[model samples]
Target: MTETTIRKPIRKAVFPVAGLGTRFLPATKAIPKEMLPIIDRPLIQYAVDEAREAGIEQLIFVTGRGKTAIVEHFDTAFELEATMSSRGKDLSILAPTRIQPGNLVTVRQQVPMGLGHAIWCARAIVGNEPFAIFLPDELMIGSPGCMKQMVEAYNEVGGNLISVLEVPEEEVSSYGVIKPGAKVSGSLTEVVGLVEKPKREEAPSNLIISGRYILQPEVMRTLEGQEKGAGGEIQLTDAMAKMIGNQAFHAVTFAGRRYDCGSKSGFVEATLELALERSDMAADVRAAIKRLAATFD
Candidate 1:
């Protein structure tokens, strides 16, 4: 690892979960969207597990009102556990839900300003280290997790790193597109510049920013200006763009399937796909689906 990489070992990760999740309403009206289970595990659990696998010591959650369920999700359910144990039932089911003490930290974003503002709210807790950001709505299914791959590249590049996923050229305008400058490694590239939701013809490349990001502390300082962008709100991409050319900037092209869990369709698809991979539920899920398909036939 380079000297810079050693100094900023990336011990903290910020999860931007304050969004109102209007797309998934009215289920989200009372429960947080992150608390919605993909199958058995909630969406936030997958994100936290990924961060923990990447050596992230602190999971900093940027949340809002009605999001207490998110915080409680990671806490010890003492009464429930005690009841389960008293019945002589196996307790391994609650294993993954348990979070170690001191590993989780949460801060409230009073208002829904924007992604940048929500992240900026964590500046104090994050202090001066280069922290990571993970959007729980995007479930990245990979062997080592997306953030771990980015950390490997971040260690070598020693600057800001964002995960890039190849989308159809027609979908370029849906995400922040990157202008590939040079190849850094196998799937890593030197990102000289980027454009937010550019038209197909204006897109720098087919690559679009994914949900994972390893950013320097300076990005928060840049967001302090609170300059509103496309949606009349401070966009994180705009602030991140300013960091280009200031240091080493690159994008790590992902080698995993990303399930967009923010929308109903995507969430259902993820549930079905993941359910098919389990031993206990695979047969039943597939048989039920096949029966349902026969009805259409």
Candidate 2:
């Protein structure tokens, strides 16, 4: 008789792109905010790229009404690609948008629910294994990428791991602050509890939860019974907080840069910053920046 061990290779990642991006206003009225491009690529593309680099095989999208653009973006543009190839255009640029038909999946949320609700809606597809959740609005650009870093940390910790970052104490109230426990060396912090948007003085720690998360299937069950929190919506933090002691919950301070693409100012800044890094756009972007700065000076 041969003994078998369960292999917990993180494979599936869920993207909650269903929310009404009201912050972006008229623009988001038609196109999903996830489709908003940072430079040449869309916000969701950066997130998808990060997930794929972390060895995630299936991309599960939790979409809402009027978000068909997201579905079309991931699907093949056979006619467009064929035309591009015939016109001597490079087809390799379209590689990131290509997800094998079998590898991509989407489930409609059907409502403007909370993040927990959005994640819970995908329960049928997530099954009984550990999975990941990414908020496309939070764009993290780095060498190893945010999710890749979390996936590597997850392989060692084997439980719920959220990518966190340090923010000014005053800004802690705007985020789900982590109630940190024992220092587990390096960037790993044992998560003793969670506080969803606590007052500045009431916050446990300055380390706030960013978008990237590696969660267990049990969370779906927890979310099933979760009530409304901060904004009267089923909060994912509430469900995650419940699993703290029962599961190995920890936080990894992401080694990268994160941009809040959900906001107009942050969106503009990210576009300019990322564009300035590209060789083809750097010179023009820099020149434009100087011209804009001269107006201020």
Candidate 3:
């Protein structure tokens, strides 16, 4: 089949969890950064739930030496389940943690390379099928979830797709901005080119690449020879840029709230906002927030 051929469905997703999270040093020393919690569920759990909602059957994780906790999080805990069952406690909460046999796969990224290198590590399992990619630290909150929205769009246009959201002009340099082409639809744009962390004056558009992606397997082939780009590491943006005209490349504008849980402020905001939405904690959280605000005043 050719590069643009519609052969297999997008049945798999890759989560790059091998990063040494130096930003959250002390906390992430022992725990994988993806295991950091937002409310009751870990950040990786949120990404997995989003992937499942999008009908993704296989979950592929690119891990590192100290990231075994991530694999354990999705495995069935017999002792914990039995304890809860015998104590007459609710077992429904543990349902999301269980994965069926062979549905989950983990590959180690031996070195701490760029995001492109990390994704390339999972090339074997992804095979020739189109797959989704989720940066677990990005906590996306939406009605149907971010990946579901991308999958719905991917169904209509079956090629490489990336999620984009408009950032302020000054903040454009902090992200990979797209050189947009013709407007495909309401929230879809034809991506003609991609620039990684361009200066504000040189930016093509304020629309920055977000964390969720549904990429064609051809991307893996391009990454095989991908040289270091902006960060002196194998940059995914550079590889994606090369595939712009070869395939049907497009960007889905995510209509949702995205918390960059990789950052401290963003993580705190996500915790408060999600907690405030919960019925069990809303009243207390709001009251505590009011008291905190008074203290600041």
> Quick one: best lDDT, which candidate?
3
Model 3: weakest 10-residue lDDT segment is: 1-10
TM-score of 2: 0.96
| Per-candidate count of clashing residue pairs (backbone under 3 Å) | 0, 0, 0
Q: Name the lDDT value of residue 282 in candidate 2.
A: 97
Clashing pairs in 2: none
lDDT of each: 0.90, 0.90, 0.92
Candidate 3 has an lDDT of 0.92
Tens-digit lDDT string for candidate 1 (1-297): 748636679899999899998998898999999999988899999999999889999999998989999999888999999999999999898887777898888999998889999999999999889999999999999987999999888877778999999999999988889999966679889998989889999999999888999999999889998589878888998898889989778999988899888778889999999999999999999999999999998
For model 1, give the 10-residue run with minimal summed lDDT.
1-10
Estimated TM-score per prediction? 0.96, 0.96, 0.97
lDDT, candidate 2, equals 0.90
* lDDT tens digits by residue: candidate 3, 1-297: 653454567899999999988899999999999999998999999999999999999999999989999999999889999999999999999899988999999999998779999999999999989999999888999978999999988888888899999989999989989999976688899999998789999999999999999999999999999998766889888898899999999999999999999999999999999999999999999999999999999
Scored by lDDT, model 1 comes in at: 0.90
